[model samples]
Target: MKKYILDLPEFILVALSAYWFLENYIGTNHFNPYAFIVFAMLLLQIYFKNKYVGFLLAWFISLFSLYMVLAVISEFRDFPTLISEGALKLLAFGLGFCFLAMGSAVLMFYKYFPKVFPARF
Candidate 1:
């Protein structure tokens, strides 16, 4: 019970990574190499139980989420303009939610499982 609670954040991170990978693979017409790389790194951590791999995966997720948030904010600065455009509004909302979810998961891991993250040499 206590162990499961502690591991919840890792489970969430894995789920989110899988979802994002599938979203990129099937949601878009073009294949995204970066998404594939993320998915692969996450799989390595999940199957190998490699602490260094987990650290690298978490670092990548955090950085990517930050980048996504900044890119979305810069692109969708005009909220009123997006609201007027039906599909664009929906797209913006979806992207924002994805980035927020990823960001929150990374934060949770950092706060609760700090030791799991490896230090850069």
Candidate 2:
């Protein structure tokens, strides 16, 4: 369905972000199964009918995206040059994605979702 184009990839990114954040932030020594659980559930979240859950999920995505923006900058700040081709490309991609994810989250907050999944919570 047309809706999948937006929702599928959006949640996929959410899952990846969640997984990466947990893995990196918490460290391997303190590994836990929660991240994997989150990744799996997010992948299945193609549709959301509950206003509260949708709002919460979108909020999470937006916050995580902001965190990603900071992470990207901090992770790359020590590079030899900020404008090197690779670095520039990465920065652009990172910013663009965060902008898009946050925008989608806003849309969800405003009840503009495309009905990508069944009722959840």
Candidate 3:
């Protein structure tokens, strides 16, 4: 068990990170609706003393969090138009709407996908 957990394949970690990043990019969410699957699987792994699974989950979560931080920075720097007081009121509204959608998507993904993560971890 230690061997499996300590020697996790790099490809799998990359794959999970890429999946999460791509999913977020397409929908403005920091994570996908399937992200929770990975999370729950991670918890199970820990309960079962699977180190590899926990590592994988941690890596993916870090990647997802990093991406979210980047997105926030990008939005803040580029959405200045949305911050201007009067002329961009409508634009600000639209941006707010997108933010809400992104937040909801991430929350939903975590809520739903944690159960889907495989026990192999």
Best by lDDT: 2
The estimated TM-scores of all candidates read 0.63, 0.58, 0.36
Alpha-carbon lDDT, every model:
0.64, 0.65, 0.49
Worst 10 residues of 2 by lDDT: 109-118
Which 10-residue span in candidate 1 carries the lowest summed lDDT?
108-117
Give the clashing pairs for model 1.
none
Q: 1-121 in candidate 1: lDDT tens per residue?
A: 8756645655666676677778877888667786677667655655665655665666666777777767776676656565568547656785866666576557545644556645767
CA shift of 4, model 3, Å = 24
On residues 1-121, what C-alpha lDDT tens digit does candidate 2 reach at each position?
6666545544655656675658665776565565565555455455444555665677787897789789888866867988798888888887876777777677655553545444687
Candidate RMSDs in Å, in order, are 4.6, 6.4, 13.1
Ranking by lDDT: 2, 1, 3
Q: Could you say which candidate leads in TM-score?
A: 1
How would you order the candidates by TM-score, starting with the best? 1, 2, 3
